[model samples]
Target: MTSAEAVPFRFFSLQVVRTRRLGPSLVRITFAGPELRDFRSDGLDQSLSLFLPHPGQDEPMVPIELGEDWWRGWMELPEDVRAVMRSYTLRELRRDADGATTEIDIDFVLHGVEPDAAVPAGPASRWAAQASAGDRVRLIGPSAADNRSIRFRPPEDTDLVLIWADETAVPAASAILESLPPGTRAVAWLEAHHAEEAQKLSVAADADLVWLVSDDGAPAAIDAVRAAQLPDAERPYVWIAGESGRMKELRRHFVNERGVDRRRVTFVGYWRQGLTEEQLREQGE
Candidate 1:
């Protein structure tokens, strides 16, 4: 525990305090615990590792007591026994009057959860779909306000901000928009599978938000962005996140077609279509 290795991020034991449905495909689960007093975040798109339990288990199984070796120990467990881990962005954090974090929210996309869905829901999605008060979980999150996990960084000189995100990345995009300074010029295109999946977002920036509903035959994400005209600005910053293949296409459109400086653009592939989290981890290794 004295190693300073866990200073930036550490394990937190939390329980579901409540749940709210933001849209047809989106659910917000709020968690609270004494461990949250140490949970610090600058909030815009802060990322974390969430560990959930399989059905019939009361809490996630994680060998956090192993300290820095928790990952290796957790991985050594049987696939079915080991906690199901997933990466997610912080939607928001609530604090007490003394500025101590009391509860934190994470938005989950309930993909494939419907009875008539084309595909079946994964472990995390299933758990979230049924999450209720007192359901326990584990999270490896930032203990510092400014950490590397928060990736929405726009250069100080950025005069125009552009963003594009699919359903999977709407939470991150929404958090980023809320953090922008008032009067900052930004344009964001957010894609949703159904019109009911669209949620009202709050932002201080002079941001124009466009909702692209797939059910309504909205144009392809790249095509929509490419066809729109951006306001005049000398320095522009672009951020795109979603399915890996589509994210790459948007990144290229921003860097090559839009002529935005590659250094100023931040792109993240939240998930790849046709690949499970376990499969993606295997490929990465």
Candidate 2:
């Protein structure tokens, strides 16, 4: 799923049609595009690359016809007009009665800002915080025929599910949880800054939710996962995400301490603790 050659890509020019606040730190951005009619997803933790314009730019200027080679083309553009690309999870995919898809939702975490206090500081977060209808952005994602890049691939024998995530990965985890089959058993340890960051979850699966409010002395995501106990199951699958350092610790605990098969675990380090996305990319993280 991490390899571009493994799953093909498609580009869409989406216009912001609506914006809403999902929580104190989350904002929902709804986008519409003609190409979206052919858009499809695996429904759990689907991610896409968004090319957002700068403050003064009305729409993001991007390269075209790159297809799988798009990254190279985008990287070659001048920084001033190239636009900033950020990866985001698909929160929800809506469809109409005739099975025609409507709009897609992406939840953005307003980082470095308080609940209804002030605008977020990050480029993506700030854009989302003040997003208005008619704003246009470029997205590189999966088309209806080539959405294989989605990373929620659990084995058929998966029985017990274990998950660990921070606020940055909550939207992806929420989509995964809500899409779980009825009667499935799963345990999740989610980290957040405050209680207001917790949103209602709609899961038919038998899920035990553990919310760890991150603060002065709160347990980290890895510590929480290490301290918890998973239910009995012949085959268990783990999906852990968020900061790279914490994920590395949790991966060791599951594969070494619990004797879980490394092949059965699907882990993603969305970002590093003390590095920006640009830094992560520059170092080939």
Model number with the top lDDT? 1
Write out the backbone clash pairs for model 2. none
Evaluate residue 5 in candidate 2 and report its C-alpha lDDT on the 0 to 100 scale: 38
- Candidate 2 error regions (>4 Å): 1-7, 65-70, 114-120, 215-217, 282-285
- Tens digit per residue, CA lDDT, model 1, 182-271: 999999999888888777877899999999998999999988999998999899998888788998898889889988889988888777
State model 2's lDDT. 0.80
- Scored by CA lDDT, what does every candidate get? 0.88, 0.80
Model 1 misses residue 267 by how many Å?
0.3
Clashes of 1: 0
RMSD of each: 1.7, 3.7
Expressed as tens digits, the lDDT of each residue in 173-258 for candidate 2 is: 98888888998999988777767777779899999988887653568666677788779888999999888887888899999988
Q: What is the lDDT for 185 in model 1?
A: 98
